[model samples]
Structures are given as C-alpha cells and as structure tokens.
Target: MNQVTNHTECSSLNNAKVAIIGAGVAGSTIALRFAELGINTTLIEKGPSLVNGPPICHLHAGGNLYREISDQQCLTLLQQSIDTVKVYPQCVNVRPTVVALPLTDKGEPQDLLPRLEMLRDKYKALVQQNPSNEVLGDPQHYFRLFERADLERIAQRELPKKALCDEDWLVAFAKQVNFDKLKFPLVLVQEYGLSAFRFAAIVSLAIERLPACTLQTNSRVIDISAKENGAGWQVTTAVNNDDRVNTAHYDYVINACGFKSGELDDMLKAKRQRMVEFKAAYVAHWPQCQGLWPEVVFYGDRGTPQGMAQLTPYPDGYFQLHGMTQAITLFEDGLVASCEQSAQPKLPARFIKKIDHHWPEQLVNDRTIGNIAHIAQFIPDFTQAITAAKPLFGAQQIPGDDPDLRAADVSFHESGYARAEIVKASSALAAADAILEDLLESGLVTSALSKRYLNEHYFPVSLQCQADEVTARAEQLAQERNYPIALANIF
Candidate 1:
C-alpha cells in the first residue's frame, strides 16, 4: 500500500480504509453509508458524541419557512427529507406546523399558495414513483387552510383532551393566537419536528454495532500528512484522556466538520471561501397550556426588531422557541466568513466558549426570557411561560456568502479527498451519496457493492437498532443535558 496515489491500485475494498473527521450530522451519515457497503471506516469526533453540534428541531420537509429560497431548493429539501426519514424513522415526530403571516409581515398569505401547490404536486409525484415516499402524509391532504371564520369556530371550543387529527392540533393554537394581528387564510403545512436526541442515539448506537466501522468519539485529529510521497493519508488523533497521540493510515479522508470545516482546509493547505453563522433556540415551560398543539411560525423580517418567531411543542407542556431577532438568537458579530489568509471563520470568543463548553447562566436566562416575551406578543397567554434551562445553540457552515442558502452538497477538490459540507441535516444523505459516487468513479468500490446497497434503501442495519433503545437513550441524553425528559419524545 506504500506510495499508492491511484485508487485503482487497491485490490480489495475490505482493505481500503477511510478516515472521517468531525462526526456531526454530515460526518455521521457519510460514515454510516461507507460502513454499510463493507468499507473500513473510522469516524473521529472532537466531541464526546456524534451529531451533537447544533439544535435540529424541525424537519424542514418543504422548506416553506423561507420565502426567499428558490422553489428548486425547496423541492430538493423535500426529497432529501424523505431520504432522512427512511433511514432514521424513529427520529421523526409526526406533527404538522402552522405557518402564519403576521400583519407586520411584508408578504401576503396568498403568496404562499403557489409554492404550496407546487410542493403538493412534487410530493404526489414522488409518492407515485414509490409509495414509501409518502412520509409527509397523503399529498392531497398535505396542506390545510384556515380563515378568520374558521378560527372563530375553533377558538371558543374546548381543547381536546387527547389530540387525534389536524382539528385537534389546532384547538390550542387557535385559542391562543391573536386573530387581530394576522392575515387571512392561515396555512397549516405537513412539516414535522425532528428529535435531535433520538437521532443521536440511533447514529451512535448503529455505528457501534457495525463491524466495518469504528466510531472514535472524544478523539481529535491533530495532524494530517501525506504518507511517503503523497501515497495516502496519515491521520494522527489525540485521545481524550491519553498523553500520547495515535496515528492511522487511510486511502481517503472526508472532512465533515460543520462550522470548523475551514480549519481542516487550512490543515490541508487549501484556502476556500465559506461562511459560518452561530445560532441558538430557547426552551420554555408552559404547564397550563391545554391539549397537543401544532408547531407555529409567525413570519417577519429576519434580523430586525420583528424577526420571525417559532413555537415548537414537546410532550408534558415543554415548548421550544426561536426568535430570529438579535436580542434572542442572533448575536453581534456572530456571523463570520473565511478570508484569503485563513479558511476558519473567527466568531466572537464568548460564542466559541459557549460552543466548547456551555453558556453562562445569566446569558441563558436573558435570552430565554426574551424569547418568551417575543412569542407572547402573538400568543398572549405565553407570557406565563418560564425559562427552561440552557439554550440549545451551535454554529452552522454555509457554502457561499448567501445568508439564506438552505441547500448545499459535497465539494470534492483533491483527488483522494472529499468535503461533506451540507447546510441542512436533510442534505446529509445526499452529501453521502455524492461522496459514494466519487468512490465508485475512482474504482474504490465495485459494482456488486453498489447493487447490494441499492436494494437496501430504508437500510436494514437501522432496523437492528430498536425504537425502545432509542426511547431510553433519548430520555437519558435529555436528562444529562439538563432538559426535560419529555423533549425527547414525540407528541
């Protein structure tokens, strides 16, 4: 294997190894893909667990939240979201989201109709191609409409003790929302919630059981160098509690560090353009609220005083809130871009400290309280809600300068190296497939293995990891992270 630059030189797929750095959503998904094909994979993570980088609450099935992104991006997101659910079905929470436009919003509620109809048609087509793709529900019932008159009828009725249908999900929300402040025909889309804790449980547990994969958490890659005349890569990693470093050889290395991706590029002596943004979501407790409620979004201008406000509900009356305004989620100088000298985006030191460890108690209280107040404007009763705990926060890497870019795929520059830089978690599988394609093109994988993988869509390895384990581990993770146990479960 010495001085082997060409991938074709490898005789056996079992012997050819891959090293992946930073086990976030993208890294974890890519590792799972390679391991399924019987390729030796080593997933190295700087953190103690995989997929722990950021808060992933919403499924973003239709990309309906962003009115700015192109319809093509929305369609791409819809397809990728279906792929994500097929692989990790336990992670999805079967809930609809109520999308509303406040009076202060610049766009009209009618403006959403065209895009919503398009999404419906696209979803129907996908389901027709393969019935399993109907993860969002029947395409005919993908969206439900509500007018001021409909709200009046539901607002006065008693909230259902046990929610069963879309009407039941709307009872609590209809009673709380301010009718005077919104436009006509509120749109309720079939977008769902994703439990990050359960997702982490599935990824970590599945990777451990795979004989071809070795998940090395708390091991940071210190250095990467060419092994003797640029044959392969020598990756040196520092174990968490060890004084000495351990090094390993690999035929290919993929860098999937979410926001710290540029640091890896710098190590490889490659200066590439990218942008990173730091964001967080607040958790609030509202015990007095009645019945199950759908996730709610009140659209407003981003980064302004009246930025968009999102309300997501968990079991046992725990609600997660996100205010796009600077006073809540956005921070001063929180967004940074790579320069010609360095590829790493330099965020404020305090943010880095919070990401490395945890946020200050006072800062957490301030942000969470501010978020409650923001939501209380629309849901007046939400003023009674109190701060839950530390906010779920992290940094995200965007491929280009467009701040609103929601879809990004893999980038391959070096012959033997690939960068899995996906903007959204839904894009994880797409990025992994892109990398797998590169391996096939380079003759690192055989046609037989590809055919074997093709038949196993909605993968079989995932079936071995049971939902009961996901439930227990998710509850444990929520408790250990200082969040309510109910946050880990679906409504």
Candidate 2:
C-alpha cells in the first residue's frame, strides 16, 4: 500500500492519511477541508474532469430547506456557505433576486396560504428577537411577501403576454391569480445564480495547489476493505485507460460520491423507501433572455401530473429547467417504463425519442422534454426559443440528494469512515464540520488540534487567493492557444 505523509506546521495530522471518494461539490469541499488541515488527503474522481455530471443551476444560501424544517444547525451552515462563496467573487455570479412561488388555485385539501403565513410569521419573529444574528440576517431583506398587485406589476414587464392569457400556465398564468386565504405570494432573497462547473473548477484547482493534497482524476475506486490488522483501510483503485491497479492505505475514508457511494460499499447504499427521479436540461441561445433572471420555483397542484419545476438562468445567456417525478426502480427492466409513465403530458414524444436514441442509460433525461414542455406553458416564448436551443447536459436519478437528506438519521458502518451526502451546496460547510467533529470524537485526531486546524482552515486564505490566480492562468492559456476565454471555453 502506498502511504503518503504531510509535512506541515500542524504536526498532529501530519501523518494522518485520508481518502475522499468522488469530486462533486460535497466531496470536493470535504477534500479541501482535510487538505487545509495538513492531512495527507487524496481526492479520487472517475471522470476526466472534477465536475463532469449535470450542471448545478443555482445556490440556495438563504435557508430555503432549513426554514421549511426549522433546523437551526442547517440555517447556520447556510450562512457559512454564503460567506465562503463570497470569498471567491470572481468564480461565482452573486445576484440579488426574489424566488417567487406562484400559488395555484387548484383544489387541494391542505391550506398552503396559512402554512406560508405561519412560516413568514415565524421568521419575522426570529428577526425581531435577534436583529444581530448572523444566520438570520435582516428579515426584511431576506424574506418578502408579494401581494397580487405586486405580482401583476412585475408580470407586465417580466412575463410574456401569452403566459398571462393562459390560466393553466405556471408563472403569471392569470391576471387575477388567487392565493386563497393569503394576502400574496412569498419570495425569498439572497438567492444567486452560480456557474456550477466554474465553481467546482475553482475548488479543484485550489485542492491541487495544496501541499498536503493529491488530486487523482480518472481514478476509480474498485474496492475498499478494512486492513487485516483493523488499524486503517486498504483502497484498491483502477486508473482510467490503464491496466495497472494501485492500492493505498488511509487512516480514514469519506464517501462523498452522492448516489454512486452505494456501488463502493453495500453498507453505504441508501435505504430509501421511494426514489424520485429528478431530471433537467440546459437550454441555451435564448435571445429574449438578455441578463440574469430570478430562480423561479413553480409549485405543482395536487392530483396534477405537474410536480415542480425550477428555472435558473446562467451567465452565458442560457437557462436550466428541471423538476422531480414519481419514484423509479433503477437497474430494473421496468425503469424506462416507469419513467415514461410518470413524465406524461409534459414530456414530448420527440424529446423522449431523442433520449432513447442518444442516452438510453439515463433515466432522468427522458423527463427533460416534459420539464421543458411544462415550462413552456407559462413562458410561451419557451417553445419557440427551445427550437434554437440545444441540449448541453443531464443526470439520472440520485438517491440521498434530496433536500430532506440532511434530516435523515446518520449512521456509520466503520469507525474510521464517514459519508457526506450533502444534497445542497449550501450544506457543504456543515458537512465538513460534522466530519471533523466525528474524527475528533472517534479518537482519530486530538480535539484541541482539530479545533485549531478547523479555525485556521474553515475559510482558508488559499481559496480567496486562488480566484485571481485561476483567472490569470485561464486567460493566459486562452491567449497562448488563441482561443476565447468565455465561460463556455473555461468551464
């Protein structure tokens, strides 16, 4: 087994070797944290690039999921995430936009208005009680309530005319849309549109620069087993496009591979009762969309095939439309049939045919057409705009990537192992904190040294310095190669 040692000022973790599987946001964040803590950390990724899967459209920093469940820890993590991202201003596009949720008039037993009102009241009281709290910033700036009049005023200038004419449309569908028993629609602030690939690239580049970090791209972990002596773990990996196999020993391993973690270890498989297949498509070259737009979430009416749709704009004049569907049984013969059955009325036959012909291995791409069709109902121009647009990327169903994953009970199979299935990017900070706490409690590292390491590396100065360095390197390479340094080229 190949063992690596860290030669840093923090000697407590100098001999500690850790391996993090996968290089998505969660995995990358954990690897960065460990690397910054002077541990001999290795980030293993199977893809050619670090961030190779479906694009992450936006970053929800204002406690969107936490506010729903009233989780105080989640809320604190959300704030830390926002602050961490702000340190890299050049890599991310931080925009102030209201996330508008249009209330539908479709008959449903549950009263959504009162629920929203109660939530608003709860947050309002929190703000009033602790005006100086960092997690719950100024409530007036963070939370907003948009009445019918405000919606109408914004619709006139923002929404297409055809959307207003269609009562069934999702956004600004009717002139007098009713929010039964409520004064108006609710909006959340501090939402930002992020270039997912760029953000990941920045972090990956920073990880590579760390003296204690080893980024092994194109390396797939084939097997991981406990050492014969029960002291650590022996990980066997197969390097892509190569016949040679390598083995490494690490004191700890973090499975941050999202849905793919199950493939590495049976114990890590998500025991989800039901799995919802979420799909999305990248639609680009929409001339109508000139600048940034709000991250819109159109709630689905009960009993309707419509579940939920998210429209997030990108800096490159492109947008992503995604949503969830009925549960699917993956790796089974009926997987395709189940996806087709759930994506009806929204997904067009042409789109489904495209997925069947091009990417049959994917279960979520089949729903891309349905998601686009659903979005077109509200934005009439969407249908026409899509004709000129092209499909850029997509991802299949991911278990444990849901908003509720954080609320689930956490259990570890091994003593020196941890799994960070952080579904939301904002939860990355909290996930790192949890892993460090576990390591300290498990006697893997000293508590005083761990705390000091965390305090020094939580918001590392290296990340802030890398922004300009990466930008300069990218621009230099673009100039040397005589190619454009646009977002598309760099990402």
Candidate 3:
C-alpha cells in the first residue's frame, strides 16, 4: 500500500468543490493543478492503483493518441501546461529506436536512398547534441532512419533459429516486424528520483500530494447528476468492493475517464459527439532473457507508420515492449478502426513466417525454455546468458551490464493506442478553451491575454451537437437555481 499526505486547504472557490472522475495521468495531473490553485478537488478512480500494463501514449510516447489536427505547436504548449501542473518533475521518459522503411515489394532499398542517407546523417547530428540515451522530447533522440542492410544483418545474425522459438517470440526478437519510418512513443516514470515505476505511481503521487483530495481505489462511480441548487454536481460511488454506496457534491464535475468517458457523458447528458474511443493494446511480457538489451527496438511495417512496438527499459534491468495504433474517429460505442498496411513497408515477412512455422513445435514441448531461447536468438545480450537458468517468473539474478533486470516478475507496463492524426491541443487545453468561450459569450471574462491563451491553446471543438445549445441550457439551469450558471462568463 502507498501512503499519500495532504497539505493545508485553500480558500478558493470559497471552498467550492470539484469532482474529477478517473485517476489516470490526465485526471490526477488536472486535480493537482486545480488543488494547487486553491480549488477543492476530489479525484475518483474506479480500480486499483496500478495495472500491469503500459502507460498512456502521450506522456511517455512522443505520439498523440488523439486526432493529429493542425497547429502541432499548440499541442506542445498544452503538454507543457500539464507539466507545469505536475508537483513532481515529469516522470515520463522516452527512448529512441531506429526504424526501417521499405521502398519496394521485392525488399530492394527505396530509390529515396539518397534522401534516407541525408536523414540518417541529420539524426546522428541530433543525437550528438543530447546524449541522454532516453527519448523524451529531445528531438535528436526520438528516432533515426536505418537502411535495409542494417536490418538484414540484424535479422540473419541476431535472431533465433526457427526450430527453437514461438512465432511471436521470433517476430519480436528478430526486429523483422515491420516498423515503418514511424516514430513510436516510450515512457518511464519514477516514484522518487531513480525509483522508477510506470504512470500509475505518478497518478498516485499526485493524489497523495493533494491536501484534501481523496483517492478511493476499487471504488466505482455508479451515478451522478446535477445538484438542485445549481451549486454544482452530485456524485454517487459504490465502494468496499462495490458493496457500499456514498454520495458527494461538488461545484464542478470533470470527466477525465479514458474509455469510460462515454458513461459520464451519458450521465451529464453531454453530446455523444463529445465522446470518442480508440482501440489500444494492453501488452505484457514473458520472463526476461538474461543479458542487457541493446537499444530498445520498434517494428511495424504498416505503411505510413500507424504504430510500432518498442522495448522500454524498466527498473531492475528489465524491459517491456508494446505497440500502439493511430487514433481515427470512432463512432459512439463503435469499435476503433484499424489501419491499412503501407504500399511498401519494411516488415520482414520471411522472418515472421519462419517464426510462425516453428512456434507450434516449440510450444508443444518446454514452452518456458522455448520463449527465452527464442528471444535470445535476436538479442545477443539475451543469447549470451541463456545457460544455467531456472524456471522463475521474475529476474533471479541481474547480469553485470544490466542492473534493472535483477528482480523476479517485473510488472508489465507498456501501452499503445491509435492516435488522432490532426494536430490538436490536449484535453486540458480544450478545457481552457471551453472556459474562455464561456466567458467571452457571457461577457464576464474579457481580457486580451485570456483570449490569446484561449485561442492559442484551444483545440478544434469536435462536439457533434450544438455547443451553443448546451451552453444556453447550462446557463438557464444555473439561473433557475441561482448558482453562478453564467458559465459563458467562466473566464
């Protein structure tokens, strides 16, 4: 169990309360920022503190999981805004990987070889500027272009023999999986300096840091509605493993739940157009192979770099590899759309075929040994350490070169999602916009700076229904109840 401490309460909002559903990175970060600004806030999470999967895409990975709209610079500014709200230094860290793009079906190098050569040289120059070896925002460390020969040699010499590994194992180890000339996102978070965990710790730490913020794990929000006085919103939760129900009221309610955003949308009567869902994978790893991984690798052959899986270093010398897809518009309650493969992608089909063909036999006998041995094939680091290993889940012993992989049973902590292609602002930025728009229309918050920030930070309003209608109704409801419903004056 983790312990969180609260600080002195503030007098802002005259103690008016705010409710934020979901305790992931976005929710908790927002809550911390609000609390720091003297807003009384409560952050509600429906599950345990952390899951053994990947973190959100944006914080760690360089890619945006939402639509990639125009005005990409605003997107950076928005993230910087969230980082400002962070009580701790940015816990998320990204590492770079070399990606190969295919030029032809016959696997011949693309005619754009000269262009790629230039890019590779440019990338090397970038790395020289910032040599952290971790890929966060450092543009130089994000990605590099590699040639066909670079990949072919890696495949033939590093990958495991077909007879010894599972298909997935082979594909992953060989680096034969197509990861087009795409930039993948990777993140690392820490509980304390040098004590790294995944995104969950970051959220938990934020909640603990809040003075009066409550983080109820395993508590589910079953119902929510408007308060009678227009004072705020009322929320109900089922806790104690959903056996008990409790209700609370707050002056404002924020829906930051990821996939569950739609449920809150329904409760608030928010337009269905305001909610969207994209498909992502929750990836876990098999036991670690002895030996330190070389630079983590990513492979996705889909044309246009929809997404790619990459290896991320974990504490105690362990590593996690996961993949993500690009986010497309999802219909209400509809499945996330898949992407089409690139016309000429660099995915190594022969390598995949070899792995798939041999996987069944390996699985039939000595599955554990087979998985490790398979990974060892492509990763020279792992291959060198395969001998004299016991069947254990966590790392029993750490190799000299890798201090992070010494533990047994490391948690799975990688996540990827389909990203929105349009360059758009983050949700926080969007909220800022909503607030400004409300103020502008209501004639309450009128300031040049405020408007500038709103314009600069605001993402394209994507809500399907009329924003005007919703704003009007909310104002009317506030007026009837005598609360500060003049939300159009939110600034």
Q: Give the TM-score ranking, best first.
A: 1, 2, 3
Tens digits of per-residue lDDT for model 2, 280-375: 354433555532355565555322455455566554445566543332111112112112223112234444454334435344434445556666
TM-score of candidate 1 versus the correct structure, residues matched by position? 0.95
Q: Rate the local accuracy (lDDT) of all candidates.
A: 0.85, 0.53, 0.35
Tens-digit lDDT string for candidate 1 (1-491):
22122123222354678888989889998888777666788999988787887799877887988998999999999999988888888999888999999999999999999999999999999999999898997799899899999988988888798766778888889888889989989998999888888888888787876667888888988888778766668999898878879989988899998899988888888777889999999999998988878999999998998999999989888988999999998887988998989888888898899998878889899999999999988999999999887898899999878888998879986777889888889899998888887777776676565644543443456546788898898888888888888888867
Q: Alpha carbon lDDT of residue 485, candidate 3?
A: 34
Task: Write the number of the candidate with greater lDDT, choosing between 1 and 3.
Answer: 1
Please list the residue runs of candidate 2 whose C-alpha ends up more than 4 Å from where it truly belongs after superposition: 1-12, 62-92, 96-138, 151-188, 267-278, 301-304, 325-370, 387-410, 453-457, 466-491
Best by lDDT: 1
For model 3, how does the per-residue alpha-carbon lDDT over 392-442 read when each residue is reduced to its tens digit?
A: 111011111221211111111111001111111123333433433543454
TM-score of each: 0.95, 0.71, 0.48
